[model samples]
Target: MNIRLNLVATTSLVALLSVSAASAQTMEELIEGAKAEGMLTTIALPHDWCGYGDIIASFKAKYPFLTVNELNPDAGSADELEAIRANKDNKGPQAPDVIDIGLSFGPQSKAEGLVQPYKVSVWDEIPDAVKDADGYYYGAYYGVMSFAVNTDLVDNVPTEWEDLLKPEYAGQVALAGDPRASNQAILGVLSAGMARGAAAGTASGEAGLQFFKELNAAGNFVPVIAKAGTLAQGTTPIMVMWDYNALAARDTLAGNPPVEVTVPTKGTLAGVYVQAISAYAPHPNAAKLWMEHIFSDEGQNGYVKGYCHTARFNTMVAQGKVPQDLLDALPPAEPYEKAYFPTVEEQDANKNAVVSGWDSVVGANVQ
Candidate 1:
């Protein structure tokens, strides 16, 4: 009977491993596999931006054994794609296990075969429009465009698009990027496109460029990308930037005067940044674990703490997966209810149009 029991135990162990090998169906299995893999690396995630700093901290606190390597905290989205291409076969820190990039980069990445498909446990909670049905990439979080106003320099905080063009705001309105090349700047224009035109917005219409043209003509449009220092120095006191950026400056610039973050009343465009596992990931198990952690309730909450609206927020609320304080921290949800998220195709097209048409519309070089 002892011999029989020993044989049965051996067979059971083999079966459990087989299931685990096929996929990490349970947290216990996922963790076990991740520990074996031992390391994970990421590209272009600035910890301070979008609550990544705290998210990384919490992730480390949870998985002490799993070494998390953050590479190039400031690399752009294009640079991230290049890294995946360069390290397709490497196993060292040079090989990225995961990537978070702009929405426009998704279709291009999938088509180029730079990433593979893997669905997190919270996959169903994510919106279908923002994620691949095959599970390659999913929306991580979205930030609505907002005004980061310097109250010291300006008496009236422009609440709407038309307010930005008023004489009082001349030389005060600044864009975050060059519309010809900057996605951030493009999103600012796109957000303004909505407020300048009808319900659908003018990404494809003539109004977007015209609005900027008028701002430029009025000397209200500052060509340079504005940063916190610029705001503090009063160079670009009123910057058109992401809501998260504006809100984050509150804590980051706590020593300076308060930075007010406001969502425009005439509707605004939202930009979604998606996360994906590298197809050439050297640490495959660790990569999946990282994805699981990011989509997990704890991970989503980390983003909330940073002032970004997580892609799974509504679902988290329904399931009671988020903390109350994090929920309370979010700016009012109604103004953003008017916020529109374009399809990947729509985003790509709009981006192309914005970049190509920027020269004709504004024509001013970023000084």
Candidate 2:
């Protein structure tokens, strides 16, 4: 079933067969094939991360006959690739059928020949830059970098990027991870530097590095990687992370300690993650079905529910698929109006530069 189409409409689940790149095998045929396979393995998807808990549950409720096995929820994008390679010879459900990976990994996965092409029904709605030309991978959802604050621990709330460098936030500002290794932390630095007109490239993302160096020197920087629980426990009173994670943390500590997610007025980076099917999926039909579900109205809505922007967010908003409350809670959309997406090549080339510069320029200042 190699039929292909890129319908831009708000495609209904019932009409999926007509729009799917896998249309030659209709929705019914795919469902039947999936049932025969009887199971799907999805790797690196934490149940609570980005509302996967709800999404994975919805999939199970929708198809009770098929079993879905989730493995290594905390695994990284590279780990997902490793899982695919290690299990290529295995036909069991131990092998991942699908993956949700960082954007930088998408093109690399395609180059490695680890991902297969199967465009979702809402293909035309997604931006071309976020998806591979041959449909090997496509963006699922994206989150903007933001400040997560523990309201109970800190009296003053920072609503701007510059606020983190203040003496008030001394020893309070924490990164999501080491800038040299963490995608989230690197982005936090990038967002800060870019907002101040910093250029990001192979020359060590200097603007970002310089901004972070100043932050560290101010005694505001903490070397620890802060998680939601860390903020709740006051280990790191302020954290730089994705808005969805901040929102999720807020919801988690609803009553005891208020957690507030802030999108800096100066600007922030929107981090996009892509989804792809394994080239050697043990259950290819189930993998295709999974993709169909993700790009459908229901699936895209899941992204909104998780506080992340769906790839087809604009289309969904125009179609009124997103509710007003969720819309209201979203970080102000203006900063994202001019959001920049670094190309895969740029991400790779500049990574070493950033890491090298971090050690020399920023790391020493970090507490």
Candidate 3:
């Protein structure tokens, strides 16, 4: 009787082991399981941008079981970084699964070890120049830094960067705050530097400080608080901004004269809002799945609808997702083909220098 009982126990254990092995999930299966877990992914993004709202809505429609808690974080990227640093160990509601921050801040965040490395399967489609080698961050969407000329304010719009220095447009051109205070503004300075024929590493390198000194001297600078819609409404006639923001401005001022957005002939600086998973994410598996979803065809096409460029190389075009006519409206990717994205080390070293130079040279004169 004892031998029969031991054999039955052994048989039961074997059966249980077989069941467990059969139930093990592949990566795809694991993703499905995570979706069913009904977990929430908290995102920190700029509340003012309309594109963000559209992206959030699309994500919810696709994943009804997953909850996305969007936090405004009213503060800019710098403020978000400070908040994250403060809550490193005890991440309160502010602890985010993902963050969408300005291009300039991407490197700093990565170097500080604030980001986690998770390479999405679609990573191969992204250009090497736009993504970090270690997969700490990847640019999800980008905008070319272009000039938004309020045709109503100036009779002859300045088409090129050098044209801004002409005596006629003096005191009319406005930048987005200081370069140090606003990354968009810095890109503007960078664009101007390129137009001025400054080589890389010169004081004028990465948007010439020397050229800005001349602009400041010429009194061509205008000052206005940086917000999404106000600049297009003629708060400041000519301002520098991202292509999406410029297009939105054009749409806003449709009835009242048009705002012309020009990509400088010398090529404009492009800024990307990169995406990264937080190191301390509570739901690591969910975060990885979310990154995969964002890079998928459906997600890439979503950006096109919002008038923003998709990050996926050819997903949108191959799938016939975006209208061909819309392609014409986008600035050719080739002109910006030589665009610069500072490395983590270079950015960290120069961030303070860029900020300090702007403060001493241009900031004091803007107001």
Whole-model Cα lDDT per candidate?
0.76, 0.76, 0.62
Which tens-of-lDDT digit does each residue in 125-197 have in candidate 1?
Answer: 7777678767668888888888998888878888888899899988888886667645567667776777766
Q: After superposition, how far is residue 273 of candidate 2 from its true place, in Å?
A: 1.3
| Of candidates 3 and 1, the better by lDDT | 1
Indicate the TM-score of model 1. Answer: 0.83
Residue range with the least summed lDDT across 10 consecutive positions in model 3: 1-10
Clashes (backbone N, CA, C under 3 Å), per candidate, total 1, 1, 3
Per-candidate TM equals 0.83, 0.83, 0.77
Model 2 segments beyond 4 Å from truth? 1-23, 92-94, 177-182, 213-219, 343-348, 355-367
lDDT comparison, 2 vs 3, better candidate: 2
Instruction: State residue 200's C-alpha deviation in candidate 3, in Å.
Output: 3.4
Clashing pairs in 3: 171-220, 190-207, 204-208
Report the lDDT tens digits of candidate 2 across residue range 141-242: 878788889988888999987778778888888876667655666667777777776555554367778878898888888777787778878889999988
Write model 3 residue lDDT over 100-142, tens digit each, in one string.
7766687777778677776777777676555776677787876
